[model samples]
Target: MIGVDWGTTSLRAYRIGASGPATDRLDRPGGILTVPQGGFPAALRDAIGPWLAAGETRVLLCGMVGSRQGWVEAPYLRCPAGPAEIAAATTAIPFAGAELRLIPGLTTEDEGGVPDVMRGEETKLVALAESLGTALACLPGTHSKWARLEDGRVTGFATHMTGETFAALSQHTILARTSVDGPDVPEAFSRGVDRARQPGGLLHHLFGARTLHLMGRLEQAETRSFLSGLLIGHEIVAAASGVTAVHLAGAAHLSALYAAALARNGIAVTQHDPDLVASGLRQIGRSLGWV
Candidate 1:
Protein backbone atom coordinates (compact mmCIF):
# COMPACT_ATOMS: atom_id res chain seq x y z
CA MET A 1 0.00 0.00 0.00
CA ILE A 2 1.14 3.56 -0.65
CA GLY A 3 0.60 6.33 1.88
CA VAL A 4 0.63 9.89 0.62
CA ASP A 5 0.81 13.03 2.71
CA TRP A 6 0.01 15.73 0.21
CA GLY A 7 -0.31 19.33 1.35
CA THR A 8 -0.37 22.80 -0.17
CA THR A 9 3.29 23.10 -1.08
CA SER A 10 4.74 19.61 -0.73
CA LEU A 11 3.87 15.97 -1.36
CA ARG A 12 5.31 12.91 0.40
CA ALA A 13 4.50 9.36 -0.67
CA TYR A 14 5.45 6.18 1.15
CA ARG A 15 5.24 2.58 -0.01
CA ILE A 16 4.56 0.46 3.06
CA GLY A 17 4.94 -3.28 3.32
CA ALA A 18 2.45 -5.43 5.29
CA SER A 19 4.29 -4.35 8.45
CA GLY A 20 7.41 -2.60 9.75
CA PRO A 21 8.84 0.57 8.09
CA ALA A 22 8.08 1.98 4.67
CA THR A 23 9.82 0.04 1.91
CA ASP A 24 10.03 3.06 -0.38
CA ARG A 25 9.53 6.85 -0.26
CA LEU A 26 9.11 9.80 -2.58
CA ASP A 27 9.15 13.55 -1.92
CA ARG A 28 8.17 16.23 -4.39
CA PRO A 29 7.17 19.88 -4.63
CA GLY A 30 4.13 18.76 -6.61
CA GLY A 31 1.63 19.83 -3.97
CA ILE A 32 -2.03 20.61 -4.54
CA LEU A 33 -1.31 24.24 -5.33
CA THR A 34 0.81 23.23 -8.32
CA VAL A 35 -1.83 20.90 -9.78
CA PRO A 36 -3.78 22.40 -12.62
CA GLN A 37 -7.58 22.78 -12.49
CA GLY A 38 -8.13 19.20 -13.59
CA GLY A 39 -4.63 17.79 -13.34
CA PHE A 40 -4.82 15.86 -10.06
CA PRO A 41 -4.97 12.52 -11.85
CA ALA A 42 -1.99 13.39 -13.99
CA ALA A 43 -0.04 14.88 -11.11
CA LEU A 44 -0.66 11.81 -8.93
CA ARG A 45 0.07 9.39 -11.76
CA ASP A 46 3.27 11.21 -12.56
CA ALA A 47 4.43 10.95 -8.96
CA ILE A 48 3.36 7.42 -8.05
CA GLY A 49 2.88 5.85 -11.44
CA PRO A 50 6.01 3.77 -11.15
CA TRP A 51 4.90 2.21 -7.89
CA LEU A 52 1.44 1.66 -9.32
CA ALA A 53 2.93 0.00 -12.36
CA ALA A 54 5.01 -2.17 -10.04
CA GLY A 55 1.84 -3.67 -8.47
CA GLU A 56 0.91 -1.23 -5.63
CA THR A 57 -2.87 -1.34 -5.74
CA ARG A 58 -3.91 0.87 -2.82
CA VAL A 59 -3.07 4.50 -1.94
CA LEU A 60 -4.20 6.35 1.16
CA LEU A 61 -3.89 10.14 0.99
CA CYS A 62 -4.05 12.68 3.80
CA GLY A 63 -3.57 16.45 4.13
CA MET A 64 -4.61 19.42 1.97
CA VAL A 65 -4.98 17.08 -0.95
CA GLY A 66 -8.37 16.30 0.64
CA SER A 67 -9.10 19.99 1.06
CA ARG A 68 -11.76 21.75 -0.99
CA GLN A 69 -9.14 23.20 -3.33
CA GLY A 70 -7.43 19.89 -3.93
CA TRP A 71 -8.39 16.76 -5.86
CA VAL A 72 -11.56 16.12 -3.89
CA GLU A 73 -12.88 17.92 -0.85
CA ALA A 74 -13.28 15.31 1.87
CA PRO A 75 -15.56 16.63 4.57
CA TYR A 76 -14.03 17.42 7.97
CA LEU A 77 -14.76 14.63 10.41
CA ARG A 78 -15.81 15.80 13.87
CA CYS A 79 -13.56 15.37 16.90
CA PRO A 80 -13.72 12.54 19.50
CA ALA A 81 -12.69 10.49 16.49
CA GLY A 82 -10.07 7.75 16.31
CA PRO A 83 -8.54 5.77 13.47
CA ALA A 84 -11.73 3.74 13.22
CA GLU A 85 -13.91 6.83 12.90
CA ILE A 86 -11.54 8.54 10.49
CA ALA A 87 -11.24 5.47 8.32
CA ALA A 88 -15.00 5.06 8.21
CA ALA A 89 -15.20 8.60 6.86
CA THR A 90 -12.51 8.15 4.23
CA THR A 91 -13.39 9.65 0.86
CA ALA A 92 -12.75 7.44 -2.14
CA ILE A 93 -11.44 8.74 -5.45
CA PRO A 94 -11.91 6.68 -8.60
CA PHE A 95 -8.72 5.74 -10.39
CA ALA A 96 -7.85 3.28 -13.10
CA GLY A 97 -6.15 0.40 -11.30
CA ALA A 98 -5.69 1.37 -7.62
CA GLU A 99 -8.06 2.05 -4.76
CA LEU A 100 -7.30 5.63 -3.61
CA ARG A 101 -8.75 7.05 -0.41
CA LEU A 102 -8.42 10.50 1.12
CA ILE A 103 -8.45 10.80 4.88
CA PRO A 104 -10.92 13.38 6.14
CA GLY A 105 -9.77 16.30 8.27
CA LEU A 106 -11.02 16.87 11.82
CA THR A 107 -13.08 19.73 13.25
CA THR A 108 -13.89 20.91 16.76
CA GLU A 109 -15.43 23.99 18.31
CA ASP A 110 -14.15 26.20 21.12
CA GLU A 111 -16.17 27.17 24.18
CA GLY A 112 -17.50 30.14 22.25
CA GLY A 113 -18.63 27.88 19.38
CA VAL A 114 -15.94 29.03 16.96
CA PRO A 115 -14.74 26.10 14.85
CA ASP A 116 -11.13 24.89 14.39
CA VAL A 117 -10.07 22.37 11.78
CA MET A 118 -7.01 20.29 10.83
CA ARG A 119 -6.25 18.16 7.80
CA GLY A 120 -2.85 16.41 7.67
CA GLU A 121 -2.06 16.59 11.38
CA GLU A 122 -4.83 14.22 12.38
CA THR A 123 -2.91 11.30 10.91
CA LYS A 124 0.16 12.10 13.01
CA LEU A 125 -1.92 12.73 16.11
CA VAL A 126 -3.66 9.38 15.74
CA ALA A 127 -0.27 7.69 15.64
CA LEU A 128 0.88 9.66 18.69
CA ALA A 129 -2.25 8.78 20.61
CA GLU A 130 -1.65 5.09 19.96
CA SER A 131 1.79 5.24 21.57
CA LEU A 132 1.35 7.89 24.30
CA GLY A 133 -2.30 7.29 25.26
CA THR A 134 -3.94 10.42 26.65
CA ALA A 135 -1.68 13.45 26.12
CA LEU A 136 -1.33 17.00 24.86
CA ALA A 137 0.19 16.88 21.38
CA CYS A 138 1.73 19.85 19.56
CA LEU A 139 2.50 19.87 15.83
CA PRO A 140 4.42 23.07 15.09
CA GLY A 141 4.36 24.67 11.65
CA THR A 142 2.79 27.68 9.89
CA HIS A 143 -0.31 27.07 12.06
CA SER A 144 0.53 25.17 15.23
CA LYS A 145 -1.99 22.75 16.76
CA TRP A 146 -2.55 21.90 20.41
CA ALA A 147 -4.76 18.82 20.59
CA ARG A 148 -6.19 16.97 23.59
CA LEU A 149 -6.26 13.22 23.25
CA GLU A 150 -8.04 10.64 25.44
CA ASP A 151 -8.10 6.87 25.08
CA GLY A 152 -6.59 7.15 21.59
CA ARG A 153 -9.23 9.54 20.36
CA VAL A 154 -8.94 13.27 19.71
CA THR A 155 -11.35 14.95 22.15
CA GLY A 156 -10.63 18.55 21.17
CA PHE A 157 -7.93 20.94 19.97
CA ALA A 158 -6.90 24.53 19.24
CA THR A 159 -4.91 26.26 16.53
CA HIS A 160 -2.24 28.95 16.95
CA MET A 161 -0.90 31.13 14.17
CA THR A 162 2.43 31.65 15.89
CA GLY A 163 4.64 30.73 12.92
CA GLU A 164 2.71 32.82 10.42
CA THR A 165 2.63 35.77 12.82
CA PHE A 166 6.35 35.51 13.45
CA ALA A 167 7.05 35.50 9.73
CA ALA A 168 4.87 38.58 9.12
CA LEU A 169 6.23 40.61 12.03
CA SER A 170 9.86 39.76 11.37
CA GLN A 171 9.73 40.11 7.59
CA HIS A 172 7.00 42.59 6.70
CA THR A 173 6.69 44.89 9.69
CA ILE A 174 8.88 47.64 11.12
CA LEU A 175 10.73 45.01 13.12
CA ALA A 176 12.17 43.76 9.84
CA ARG A 177 14.32 46.88 9.54
CA THR A 178 16.25 45.87 12.66
CA SER A 179 16.41 42.09 12.22
CA VAL A 180 18.85 40.02 10.18
CA ASP A 181 18.92 36.40 9.15
CA GLY A 182 21.40 34.36 11.15
CA PRO A 183 21.94 31.15 13.07
CA ASP A 184 19.83 30.35 16.11
CA VAL A 185 20.76 32.37 19.19
CA PRO A 186 19.75 30.33 22.22
CA GLU A 187 20.43 33.12 24.72
CA ALA A 188 18.46 35.70 22.73
CA PHE A 189 15.60 33.23 22.27
CA SER A 190 15.56 32.45 25.98
CA ARG A 191 15.47 36.15 26.76
CA GLY A 192 12.49 36.65 24.46
CA VAL A 193 10.68 33.78 26.14
CA ASP A 194 11.38 35.26 29.54
CA ARG A 195 10.12 38.64 28.35
CA ALA A 196 6.81 37.08 27.42
CA ARG A 197 6.18 36.42 31.11
CA GLN A 198 6.63 40.11 31.88
CA PRO A 199 3.93 42.78 32.21
CA GLY A 200 1.99 44.35 29.31
CA GLY A 201 0.63 42.27 26.37
CA LEU A 202 1.97 40.73 23.17
CA LEU A 203 1.31 43.93 21.18
CA HIS A 204 3.51 45.91 23.55
CA HIS A 205 6.14 43.16 23.55
CA LEU A 206 6.30 43.28 19.74
CA PHE A 207 7.11 46.99 19.80
CA GLY A 208 9.89 46.33 22.28
CA ALA A 209 11.63 44.24 19.61
CA ARG A 210 12.08 47.42 17.57
CA THR A 211 12.71 49.85 20.40
CA LEU A 212 15.37 47.61 21.93
CA HIS A 213 17.16 47.52 18.59
CA LEU A 214 17.08 51.31 18.24
CA MET A 215 18.33 51.65 21.81
CA GLY A 216 21.21 49.28 20.96
CA ARG A 217 19.93 46.72 23.46
CA LEU A 218 18.98 44.02 20.93
CA GLU A 219 21.46 43.07 18.23
CA GLN A 220 20.33 42.90 14.61
CA ALA A 221 21.47 39.32 14.13
CA GLU A 222 19.55 38.05 17.14
CA THR A 223 16.41 40.02 16.42
CA ARG A 224 14.79 37.30 14.29
CA SER A 225 15.36 34.55 16.85
CA PHE A 226 14.14 36.90 19.57
CA LEU A 227 11.03 37.65 17.59
CA SER A 228 10.45 33.94 17.04
CA GLY A 229 10.80 33.18 20.73
CA LEU A 230 8.47 36.03 21.57
CA LEU A 231 5.76 34.76 19.27
CA ILE A 232 6.16 31.11 20.24
CA GLY A 233 6.34 32.16 23.88
CA HIS A 234 2.99 33.93 23.68
CA GLU A 235 1.48 30.98 21.83
CA ILE A 236 2.55 28.56 24.53
CA VAL A 237 1.06 30.79 27.18
CA ALA A 238 -2.28 30.77 25.39
CA ALA A 239 -2.48 27.14 24.19
CA ALA A 240 -0.58 25.26 26.86
CA SER A 241 -2.54 26.41 29.87
CA GLY A 242 -3.04 23.67 32.53
CA VAL A 243 -0.82 21.26 30.61
CA THR A 244 2.39 19.87 32.10
CA ALA A 245 3.87 18.18 29.00
CA VAL A 246 3.65 18.23 25.22
CA HIS A 247 4.24 15.60 22.53
CA LEU A 248 6.00 17.72 19.94
CA ALA A 249 6.33 16.93 16.23
CA GLY A 250 7.46 18.73 13.06
CA ALA A 251 10.57 19.60 11.01
CA ALA A 252 13.72 19.35 13.11
CA HIS A 253 14.60 23.04 13.31
CA LEU A 254 11.06 24.25 14.02
CA SER A 255 10.50 21.46 16.53
CA ALA A 256 13.71 22.43 18.32
CA LEU A 257 12.57 26.03 18.55
CA TYR A 258 9.19 24.96 19.91
CA ALA A 259 10.83 22.55 22.34
CA ALA A 260 12.96 25.39 23.73
CA ALA A 261 9.94 27.63 24.11
CA LEU A 262 7.88 24.85 25.66
CA ALA A 263 10.65 24.03 28.12
CA ARG A 264 10.96 27.69 29.15
CA ASN A 265 7.29 27.48 30.15
CA GLY A 266 8.01 24.55 32.53
CA ILE A 267 6.40 22.05 30.20
CA ALA A 268 7.98 18.63 29.70
CA VAL A 269 8.55 17.83 26.04
CA THR A 270 8.82 14.45 24.28
CA GLN A 271 9.68 14.87 20.64
CA HIS A 272 8.38 12.41 18.02
CA ASP A 273 9.62 11.53 14.56
CA PRO A 274 8.05 13.66 11.80
CA ASP A 275 7.35 10.53 9.79
CA LEU A 276 4.46 9.62 12.09
CA VAL A 277 2.26 10.51 9.13
CA ALA A 278 3.18 7.17 7.57
CA SER A 279 2.32 5.38 10.79
CA GLY A 280 -0.96 7.21 10.86
CA LEU A 281 -1.77 6.31 7.28
CA ARG A 282 -0.96 2.68 7.97
CA GLN A 283 -3.13 2.60 11.07
CA ILE A 284 -6.04 4.09 9.20
CA GLY A 285 -5.42 1.74 6.30
CA ARG A 286 -5.76 -1.28 8.55
CA SER A 287 -9.07 0.01 9.82
CA LEU A 288 -10.21 0.35 6.23
CA GLY A 289 -8.93 -3.15 5.44
CA TRP A 290 -6.62 -1.77 2.76
CA VAL A 291 -3.48 -3.49 4.12
Candidate 2:
Protein backbone atom coordinates (compact mmCIF):
# COMPACT_ATOMS: atom_id res chain seq x y z
CA MET A 1 0.00 0.00 0.00
CA ILE A 2 1.09 3.57 -0.68
CA GLY A 3 0.65 6.18 2.05
CA VAL A 4 1.06 9.77 1.04
CA ASP A 5 1.29 12.79 3.34
CA TRP A 6 0.69 15.63 0.93
CA GLY A 7 0.62 18.96 2.69
CA THR A 8 1.05 22.59 1.62
CA THR A 9 4.83 22.67 1.15
CA SER A 10 5.94 19.02 1.00
CA LEU A 11 4.83 15.59 -0.22
CA ARG A 12 6.01 12.35 1.38
CA ALA A 13 5.00 8.93 0.02
CA TYR A 14 5.66 5.75 1.94
CA ARG A 15 5.54 2.25 0.51
CA ILE A 16 4.21 0.11 3.35
CA GLY A 17 4.56 -3.63 3.72
CA ALA A 18 2.04 -5.94 5.42
CA SER A 19 3.81 -5.14 8.70
CA GLY A 20 6.76 -3.13 10.06
CA PRO A 21 8.11 0.17 8.74
CA ALA A 22 7.89 1.51 5.22
CA THR A 23 9.80 -0.61 2.71
CA ASP A 24 10.50 2.45 0.58
CA ARG A 25 9.71 6.15 0.58
CA LEU A 26 9.78 9.25 -1.60
CA ASP A 27 10.04 12.88 -0.65
CA ARG A 28 9.30 15.85 -2.89
CA PRO A 29 8.74 19.57 -2.45
CA GLY A 30 5.68 19.38 -4.67
CA GLY A 31 2.95 19.85 -2.08
CA ILE A 32 -0.71 20.37 -2.91
CA LEU A 33 -0.23 24.09 -3.33
CA THR A 34 2.07 23.46 -6.26
CA VAL A 35 -0.48 21.33 -8.06
CA PRO A 36 -2.37 23.39 -10.58
CA GLN A 37 -6.12 23.09 -11.10
CA GLY A 38 -7.06 19.59 -12.26
CA GLY A 39 -3.49 18.53 -11.73
CA PHE A 40 -3.67 16.31 -8.64
CA PRO A 41 -4.00 13.12 -10.66
CA ALA A 42 -0.90 13.92 -12.65
CA ALA A 43 0.97 14.94 -9.53
CA LEU A 44 0.11 11.65 -7.81
CA ARG A 45 1.08 9.73 -10.92
CA ASP A 46 4.33 11.62 -11.12
CA ALA A 47 5.22 10.79 -7.52
CA ILE A 48 4.11 7.16 -7.17
CA GLY A 49 3.62 5.94 -10.72
CA PRO A 50 6.38 3.38 -10.33
CA TRP A 51 4.72 1.84 -7.26
CA LEU A 52 1.35 1.72 -8.98
CA ALA A 53 3.00 0.10 -12.00
CA ALA A 54 4.41 -2.48 -9.61
CA GLY A 55 0.80 -3.41 -8.71
CA GLU A 56 0.35 -1.31 -5.57
CA THR A 57 -3.45 -1.10 -5.51
CA ARG A 58 -4.20 0.90 -2.38
CA VAL A 59 -3.29 4.48 -1.49
CA LEU A 60 -4.21 6.47 1.62
CA LEU A 61 -3.42 10.16 1.99
CA CYS A 62 -3.58 12.63 4.85
CA GLY A 63 -2.91 16.34 5.44
CA MET A 64 -3.84 19.59 3.74
CA VAL A 65 -4.26 17.55 0.57
CA GLY A 66 -7.71 16.72 1.92
CA SER A 67 -8.53 20.34 2.63
CA ARG A 68 -10.96 22.39 0.55
CA GLN A 69 -7.95 23.65 -1.41
CA GLY A 70 -6.60 20.19 -2.19
CA TRP A 71 -7.91 17.35 -4.36
CA VAL A 72 -11.16 16.85 -2.44
CA GLU A 73 -12.48 18.52 0.66
CA ALA A 74 -12.74 15.73 3.22
CA PRO A 75 -14.90 17.32 5.85
CA TYR A 76 -13.54 17.42 9.41
CA LEU A 77 -14.61 14.97 12.11
CA ARG A 78 -15.41 16.49 15.48
CA CYS A 79 -13.26 15.90 18.57
CA PRO A 80 -13.35 12.80 20.80
CA ALA A 81 -12.81 10.76 17.61
CA GLY A 82 -10.58 7.74 17.14
CA PRO A 83 -9.02 5.78 14.26
CA ALA A 84 -12.36 4.10 13.57
CA GLU A 85 -14.08 7.42 13.15
CA ILE A 86 -11.25 8.74 10.97
CA ALA A 87 -11.26 5.64 8.77
CA ALA A 88 -15.01 5.79 8.37
CA ALA A 89 -14.73 9.44 7.39
CA THR A 90 -12.06 8.90 4.72
CA THR A 91 -13.05 10.46 1.40
CA ALA A 92 -12.40 8.46 -1.75
CA ILE A 93 -11.11 10.04 -4.93
CA PRO A 94 -11.33 8.53 -8.38
CA PHE A 95 -8.14 6.98 -9.71
CA ALA A 96 -7.77 4.30 -12.32
CA GLY A 97 -4.93 2.19 -10.88
CA ALA A 98 -5.61 2.46 -7.16
CA GLU A 99 -8.27 2.85 -4.50
CA LEU A 100 -7.30 6.28 -3.14
CA ARG A 101 -8.65 7.68 0.12
CA LEU A 102 -8.09 11.01 1.85
CA ILE A 103 -8.11 11.30 5.64
CA PRO A 104 -10.40 13.96 7.00
CA GLY A 105 -9.13 16.60 9.44
CA LEU A 106 -10.36 16.97 13.06
CA THR A 107 -12.04 19.86 14.86
CA THR A 108 -12.81 20.87 18.45
CA GLU A 109 -13.81 23.97 20.33
CA ASP A 110 -12.05 26.04 22.99
CA GLU A 111 -13.61 27.02 26.33
CA GLY A 112 -15.08 30.14 24.68
CA GLY A 113 -16.55 28.00 21.85
CA VAL A 114 -14.24 29.10 19.02
CA PRO A 115 -13.36 26.17 16.73
CA ASP A 116 -9.86 24.66 16.35
CA VAL A 117 -8.88 22.32 13.52
CA MET A 118 -5.97 20.09 12.51
CA ARG A 119 -5.26 18.06 9.39
CA GLY A 120 -2.06 16.02 8.98
CA GLU A 121 -1.32 16.18 12.70
CA GLU A 122 -4.43 14.11 13.58
CA THR A 123 -2.86 11.10 11.93
CA LYS A 124 0.20 11.35 14.17
CA LEU A 125 -2.00 11.83 17.23
CA VAL A 126 -3.90 8.67 16.30
CA ALA A 127 -0.64 6.77 16.11
CA LEU A 128 0.51 8.22 19.42
CA ALA A 129 -2.77 7.38 21.13
CA GLU A 130 -2.42 3.78 20.02
CA SER A 131 0.85 3.59 21.92
CA LEU A 132 0.56 6.13 24.74
CA GLY A 133 -3.16 5.61 25.43
CA THR A 134 -3.92 8.80 27.32
CA ALA A 135 -1.52 11.74 26.99
CA LEU A 136 -0.82 15.31 25.96
CA ALA A 137 0.98 15.90 22.65
CA CYS A 138 2.74 18.84 21.10
CA LEU A 139 3.32 18.96 17.31
CA PRO A 140 5.45 21.99 16.52
CA GLY A 141 5.63 23.62 13.12
CA THR A 142 4.47 26.78 11.33
CA HIS A 143 1.38 26.40 13.48
CA SER A 144 2.02 24.26 16.56
CA LYS A 145 -0.68 22.00 18.01
CA TRP A 146 -1.37 20.99 21.62
CA ALA A 147 -3.52 17.87 21.59
CA ARG A 148 -4.99 15.69 24.31
CA LEU A 149 -5.57 11.98 23.76
CA GLU A 150 -7.70 9.85 26.05
CA ASP A 151 -7.81 6.10 25.55
CA GLY A 152 -6.95 6.28 21.83
CA ARG A 153 -9.17 9.20 20.95
CA VAL A 154 -8.33 12.90 20.58
CA THR A 155 -10.42 14.73 23.17
CA GLY A 156 -9.41 18.28 22.25
CA PHE A 157 -6.51 20.43 21.02
CA ALA A 158 -5.37 24.00 20.43
CA THR A 159 -3.25 25.75 17.79
CA HIS A 160 -0.40 28.22 18.33
CA MET A 161 1.08 30.37 15.58
CA THR A 162 4.51 30.55 17.25
CA GLY A 163 6.54 29.60 14.16
CA GLU A 164 4.58 31.89 11.85
CA THR A 165 4.76 34.73 14.31
CA PHE A 166 8.49 34.20 14.81
CA ALA A 167 9.03 34.38 11.07
CA ALA A 168 7.13 37.66 10.83
CA LEU A 169 8.86 39.21 13.83
CA SER A 170 12.34 38.10 12.86
CA GLN A 171 12.09 38.80 9.13
CA HIS A 172 9.46 41.46 8.44
CA THR A 173 9.30 43.65 11.52
CA ILE A 174 11.65 46.08 13.25
CA LEU A 175 12.95 43.10 15.20
CA ALA A 176 14.46 41.93 11.92
CA ARG A 177 16.90 44.84 12.04
CA THR A 178 18.65 43.28 15.03
CA SER A 179 18.30 39.68 13.99
CA VAL A 180 20.65 37.64 11.79
CA ASP A 181 20.44 34.04 10.74
CA GLY A 182 22.92 31.79 12.47
CA PRO A 183 23.30 28.50 14.27
CA ASP A 184 21.38 27.82 17.49
CA VAL A 185 22.39 29.88 20.52
CA PRO A 186 21.42 27.80 23.51
CA GLU A 187 22.29 30.50 26.05
CA ALA A 188 20.20 33.14 24.31
CA PHE A 189 17.37 30.73 23.82
CA SER A 190 17.39 29.71 27.46
CA ARG A 191 17.43 33.36 28.47
CA GLY A 192 14.39 34.00 26.30
CA VAL A 193 12.63 31.02 27.81
CA ASP A 194 13.40 32.37 31.27
CA ARG A 195 12.05 35.77 30.28
CA ALA A 196 8.79 34.20 29.19
CA ARG A 197 8.30 32.95 32.74
CA GLN A 198 8.39 36.51 34.01
CA PRO A 199 5.41 38.82 34.58
CA GLY A 200 5.12 40.69 31.23
CA GLY A 201 2.97 39.33 28.39
CA LEU A 202 4.19 38.19 24.95
CA LEU A 203 3.79 41.59 23.24
CA HIS A 204 5.92 43.33 25.83
CA HIS A 205 8.38 40.42 25.81
CA LEU A 206 8.71 40.58 22.00
CA PHE A 207 9.91 44.19 22.07
CA GLY A 208 12.61 43.19 24.54
CA ALA A 209 14.28 41.35 21.67
CA ARG A 210 15.07 44.77 20.22
CA THR A 211 15.78 46.68 23.40
CA LEU A 212 18.18 44.04 24.62
CA HIS A 213 20.06 44.30 21.33
CA LEU A 214 20.23 48.10 21.47
CA MET A 215 21.54 47.95 25.00
CA GLY A 216 24.32 45.64 23.76
CA ARG A 217 22.86 42.92 25.93
CA LEU A 218 21.91 40.59 23.04
CA GLU A 219 24.05 39.79 20.05
CA GLN A 220 22.60 40.09 16.55
CA ALA A 221 23.21 36.42 15.78
CA GLU A 222 21.34 35.35 18.90
CA THR A 223 18.21 37.33 18.13
CA ARG A 224 16.57 34.61 16.03
CA SER A 225 17.06 31.88 18.61
CA PHE A 226 15.98 34.18 21.39
CA LEU A 227 12.81 35.16 19.56
CA SER A 228 11.99 31.50 18.90
CA GLY A 229 12.47 30.60 22.56
CA LEU A 230 10.35 33.52 23.67
CA LEU A 231 7.45 32.54 21.44
CA ILE A 232 7.62 28.82 22.20
CA GLY A 233 7.96 29.57 25.91
CA HIS A 234 4.85 31.71 25.81
CA GLU A 235 3.01 28.95 23.97
CA ILE A 236 3.97 26.42 26.62
CA VAL A 237 2.88 28.76 29.38
CA ALA A 238 -0.55 28.99 27.82
CA ALA A 239 -1.13 25.50 26.41
CA ALA A 240 0.79 23.23 28.75
CA SER A 241 -0.57 24.66 31.98
CA GLY A 242 -1.55 21.48 33.80
CA VAL A 243 0.41 18.85 31.86
CA THR A 244 3.51 17.37 33.50
CA ALA A 245 4.57 15.44 30.39
CA VAL A 246 4.08 15.92 26.63
CA HIS A 247 4.66 13.75 23.56
CA LEU A 248 6.65 15.94 21.19
CA ALA A 249 6.76 15.40 17.40
CA GLY A 250 8.22 17.34 14.47
CA ALA A 251 11.49 17.87 12.56
CA ALA A 252 14.51 17.18 14.78
CA HIS A 253 15.61 20.79 15.10
CA LEU A 254 12.17 22.17 15.95
CA SER A 255 11.48 19.26 18.27
CA ALA A 256 14.70 19.96 20.15
CA LEU A 257 13.74 23.60 20.55
CA TYR A 258 10.27 22.76 21.83
CA ALA A 259 11.75 20.15 24.14
CA ALA A 260 13.99 22.76 25.66
CA ALA A 261 11.17 25.22 26.22
CA LEU A 262 8.94 22.47 27.57
CA ALA A 263 11.66 21.27 29.89
CA ARG A 264 12.08 24.80 31.18
CA ASN A 265 8.46 24.68 32.27
CA GLY A 266 9.29 21.56 34.34
CA ILE A 267 7.50 19.36 31.84
CA ALA A 268 8.79 15.89 30.99
CA VAL A 269 9.22 15.22 27.26
CA THR A 270 9.00 12.02 25.22
CA GLN A 271 9.99 12.58 21.62
CA HIS A 272 8.23 10.65 18.84
CA ASP A 273 9.33 10.08 15.26
CA PRO A 274 8.25 12.87 12.94
CA ASP A 275 7.22 10.31 10.33
CA LEU A 276 4.56 8.71 12.53
CA VAL A 277 2.13 9.67 9.79
CA ALA A 278 2.92 6.32 8.12
CA SER A 279 2.06 4.44 11.30
CA GLY A 280 -1.04 6.61 11.57
CA LEU A 281 -2.15 5.99 7.99
CA ARG A 282 -1.59 2.30 8.56
CA GLN A 283 -3.80 2.34 11.65
CA ILE A 284 -6.61 4.03 9.73
CA GLY A 285 -6.16 1.59 6.86
CA ARG A 286 -6.34 -1.30 9.31
CA SER A 287 -9.61 0.04 10.71
CA LEU A 288 -11.03 -0.03 7.17
CA GLY A 289 -9.65 -3.53 6.42
CA TRP A 290 -7.50 -1.97 3.72
CA VAL A 291 -4.07 -2.63 5.25
lDDT of each: 0.92, 0.92
User: lDDT tens string, model 1, 1-291?
Assistant: 999999999999999866899989999998899999999998999999999999999999999999989999999999999999999999999999999999999999999999999999999999998888899999999999999999988999999998888888888989988667889899889889988888899999999998888898989988988888888898888898878999998999999999999999999999989879889999999898888
RMSD to truth, every model: 1.3, 1.4
For model 2, what is the C-alpha lDDT against the true structure?
0.92
- What TM-score, over all chains together, does every model reach? 0.96, 0.95
In model 1, where is the ten-residue run with the lowest total lDDT? 175-184
- Report how far residue 194 has shifted in candidate 2, in Å: 1.1
User: How does residue 157 of candidate 2 score in lDDT?
Assistant: 97
lDDT of model 1 at position 231: 87
lDDT of 2 by residue, 23-133 (tens): 889999999999999999999999999999998999999999999899999999999989999999899899988999999999999999999999999999999999998
| Candidate 2, number of clashes | 0
**TM-score of decoy 1:** 0.96
